[model samples]
Target: MKTLQVDLGQRSYPIYIGSRLLEQADLLTRHIRSKQVLIVTNETVAPLYLQQVLDNLSDFVVETVILPDGEQYKTLDYLNRIFDTLLTHKFSRNASLIALGGGVIGDMGGFAAACYQRGIPFIQIPTTLLAQVDSSVGGKTGVNHPLGKNMIGAFYQPQCVIADMSVLSTLDDRQLSAGIAEVIKYGLIREPDFFAWLEDNLESLLDRDVEALAHAVERSCRNKAEVVAADEKEADVRATLNLGHTFGHAIETGMGYGSYLHGEAVAIGTCQAADLSRRKGWLTDADVERIIRLFKRARLPVEPPAALDANRFIELMAVDKKNVDGNIRLILLKSIGEATLPVGVEKALLVATLNGYGRKG
Candidate 1:
């Protein structure tokens, strides 16, 4: 097993990444603060791995809440179910909640922990590649609103993150491709060499090569941990992590959620950002093409849905967290490996990219 730390001083926690980690009870039990435990998972994952997690906490007063699976279910309404379970059980602040599914479960579980009794301990046992590489490590937890994605959330760190690679064996091909989108994001935002490495090794990842998967997860987590430690609240450099999220969140909300998986929307949004960067003369035509080609090779969509016109896209984007005083700021690429922080672009330039970049000509 390989362990990485999110160095947040008092809030520091280790991220355990390896195969069959669920079989190791101590890795999870040691982080629990009390006898009361709540395992928040979804219907899809419960049948597959809930018992394995339950077996580990046999001695504790454990309760399980199996949420309906999908991005559409990630909302304040569904999040209240976790609270209902906790309140019904009379779980105390010391009680620890274990998030045992994909990003939806992780986000809701963490948000529940953050809000219950003001605060409580929680551990992340992320079962999906998207959660392991991005959502699980960052401590950014929340449910989506009708107006925006993740607009209501907090930066509550986890006790520890158990990224068991064995669980990924059950992940479908589409979900696997979705996870790779975030992996590719790290390279585009800052890791130039890693981007080049992905160009050569992406085939191995698609084949589910264990070594390649581990390397990608570890490197992606390391990049996340480093950035989070520096700007836990997204005061500066952290905002750069939302390279394509501004446009992507707009897609998610505009499409009424679950229509496009989070990673799929990100893949498309990143491509649009690359095109906008080209318009600003920051990246060449070749650079834009390279970005789009990678997403296509990963089996991800690089085009925005035709249903969302530029005006609708802009309206949705204006609800983003990164926007300041009604100005829709975006994280655009300065180069393949370097991303600019949230910056407000000229409305005309932004409109041009929105109308022209991904439209069928």
Candidate 2:
């Protein structure tokens, strides 16, 4: 097992990444603060791994909330179910929540821990690749609002993250590909050598080579931990982590959630960001093509939906968290490895990319 720390001083926590970690009860039990525990998972994951987690918590007063699975279910309405379970069971502030599914479960479970009795302890046992690499490490937790994605959330850290690689064996091909999108994001935003490595070894990752998957998860988590430690609240460098998220969030909110998986939308949005960067003379035509090819090779979508035109995208993007005083700021690429922080671009230029970048002339 390899352990990495988030390094938030008082809030610091370790992320345990390895195979069959669920079999290690101590890795999870040591983090729980009290006897009362709530395991928030979804219907899809409950049958597969819930019992393994339950096996570890046999001594605690445990309750389970099996949420309906999908991005569409990640809302204030569904989040209240966790609260209902907590309140019905009269769980105390010292009680810990175990988010035992993918990103939606992690986000909602963490948010519940953050809001219940003002705060409580929680641990993340992220079952999906997307959650393991991105959502689980960062303290950013919340449900999606109808107006914007992740607009109502908090920067609440987890007690510890258990990224058991063994659970990924049950993940479908599409969901596995979705996770690779975020893994690829780390390389695009900062790790140039990692990006080059991905170019050569993506096939190995697709084949679920144990060493390659472990390396990708560890390296991606390391990159995320370093950035979060420096700027926990996204005051500066942290915003760079949202490289394609602004446009991607727009896609999620515009199309209604779950139409595109979060990582699929990010892949498309990053391609658009590369297009805008090319327009601004930051990336060449070859650079844009290279970026698109990688997402394609990963089996992710690289084109924005035809249903969302420039005007609709603009409306949706205006509601983003990164926007300041109605100005829609975006994280664009300066190069393959270096990403610019959120910056305001000319509306005309932005419109041109939104209108022309992915559409046939």
Candidate 3:
């Protein structure tokens, strides 16, 4: 297993990546606070890998809660189910919660772990590529409010993150591409060289070349860990992580959640931001072309979803957690490997990009 440490002082933890890491007891034994464990997963993943995880913990008492699949279920109602299960089992503060699926599972389970008895230790066993690279780290846990995406989360950190790459084998092609969008983001915001590598190795990534996937996942996590360690609460430097999120969350919420994968929505949002940046002189047309080219190669939709009207898009963007005062701020490209959050970006330019709608990536 390849381990990456997120050094957040006392809250620091390790993200373990590899095949069959889920079945390794030492991965959990070293981090877990107690023996009473609850493995929270969705219906889609519970049947596939839950038992394998259970077999490894033959020594510890285990309970399983299977939530129905999809982003729509990532709500307080679902979180209540975890609490209800814990209460039923008489679980205490010493017990641990295991997030055993993709991003939704990790977010929801992490949120539940954060709030229960004020807070309890939780482990992120992220199964999807998107989860492995983004949501599973940083401990930004919360259930989405009807009003906005992740509008009600806390800056709570997790005990550890177990990213078992073996889980990617079950994902569909669309799901695979969604994960690549974030992989591409790490390259876009911080490491230009990784972006260049992605441009050169797009086909290898699509083909599941093990070395390429490992490099992509490792570098993305390393970049994120450094960022999260610096700004756990997203005060300044950390906000850069929202590269495509402001527009992406609006797209997901404006139309409806689960209509598009989180990473897929971000891909379109990243493209829209690229266009806006080019118009504002922050990025060149060539830069836009290169970004869209890499996204196209990954099979992600570089075009915005049709349902997000300009006014509604702006409205959603207005309430973004990243916005300061009334002006919208965005992580725009200075170039492929570098990005910046320029405040007070003109609304007209944003509208133009949104209206560009079907522009080919």
Report per-prediction Cα RMSD to one decimal. 0.8, 0.8, 1.5
Model 2 has an lDDT value of 0.93
Residue 100 displacement in candidate 3 (angstroms): 0.4
lDDT of 3 at 359: 47
Q: How close is candidate 2 to the true structure, as a TM-score?
A: 0.99
lDDT of 3 by residue, 72-148 (tens): 99999999999999889988998999999999999999999899898999998888899999997788888888889
- Expressed as tens digits, the lDDT of each residue in 1-361 for candidate 2 is 9999889999999999999999999999999989999999999999999999999999999999999999898899998999999999999999999999999999999998999999999999999999999998879999987787887888899999999888888998899999999999999999999999999999998888777888999999999999999999989899998988888998988898999999999999999999999999999999899989999999999989999999999999998888899999999999999999999999999999999888976
How many pairs of residues collide in model 1? 0
- TM-score for every candidate vs. truth? 0.99, 0.99, 0.97
> In model 1, what lDDT does residue 283 have?
96
Query: Once model 2 is optimally superposed onto the true structure by TM-score, how far is the C-alpha of residue 136 displaced, in angstroms?
Result: 0.8
Model 1, residue 198: displacement in angstroms?
Answer: 0.8
Would you list the clashing residue pairs of candidate 1? none
- Candidate 3, TM-score vs. the true structure? 0.97
lDDT of 1: 0.93
